[model samples]
Target: MATAGLITWPVTLTIGAGHLLAHNKHMRLLRSFGEALEEA
Candidate 1:
C-alpha cells in the first residue's frame, strides 16, 4: 500500500546509502593499495 511504502521509503534509502558507502569505501581502499604497490 502507499502508506506502507511511504513509511518504508526512508528505511530503504538508508539501506541503499549504506551499500553505496560500503562499495565506495572498498573501491577507495583498493585504489590506495594499488597506488602504494605501484610506488613500491
Candidate 2:
C-alpha cells in the first residue's frame, strides 16, 4: 500500500545509512573475508 511504503521508505534509508557506516568502518576486514571465502 502507498501508506505503508511511505512509512517504510525512511526506515529503509536509515537502516541503509547505518549499514554503510559500518561497512566503511570495517571495509578492509570485510574485503579480506570475502577474498578468503572465494578461495575456499
Candidate 3:
C-alpha cells in the first residue's frame, strides 16, 4: 500500500498541474475574445 501511494502521488500532482494549466489557458482565451468583441 505504501508503494502504491508513492507511485500515485506524482501522478496526482501531474494531473492537477495539467488541469490548472488548461483552466488558465481557457480563461485567457475567453478574456481575449471578450476584448475583441468590445473593439468590434
Candidate 4:
C-alpha cells in the first residue's frame, strides 16, 4: 500500500492543481464580464 500511495499522491496533486487553475480562470472570466456590464 505504501507504494500505491506514493504513486497516487502526485496524480491526486495534479488533479487538484488542475481544478484550482480552472476555477481561477472561471473567476477571472466572470470578473471581466461583471466589469463590462458595469461599464455598459
CA RMSD of each candidate after superposition: 3.6, 5.3, 3.8, 3.7
19 Cα displacement, candidate 3 (Å): 0.3
Clashing pairs in 4: none
TM-score list, all predictions = 0.75, 0.50, 0.81, 0.82
Q: Could you give candidate 2's per-residue lDDT for residues 1-40 as a string of tens digits?
A: 3356755767787888999998887998889999999999
Q: On TM-score, who's better, 1 or 4? A: 4
lDDT of 1 at 26: 100
What residue runs in model 4 are displaced by over 4 Å at the alpha carbon?
1-7
Q: Write the residue-wise lDDT of candidate 4 on 1-40 in tens digits.
A: 3356755867788888999999999999999999999999
Query: Clash number for every model?
Result: 0, 0, 0, 0
Q: Mark the regions of model 2 whose C-alpha exceeds 4 Å error after superposition.
A: 1-7, 28-40
Q: How many Å off is the CA of 32 in candidate 4? A: 0.0
Candidate 2 accuracy as TM-score: 0.50
Candidate 4: clashing residue pairs, number: 0
Per-residue lDDT tens digits for candidate 3, residues 1-40, read 3356755767788888999999999999999999999999
The lDDT per prediction is: 0.87, 0.83, 0.87, 0.87
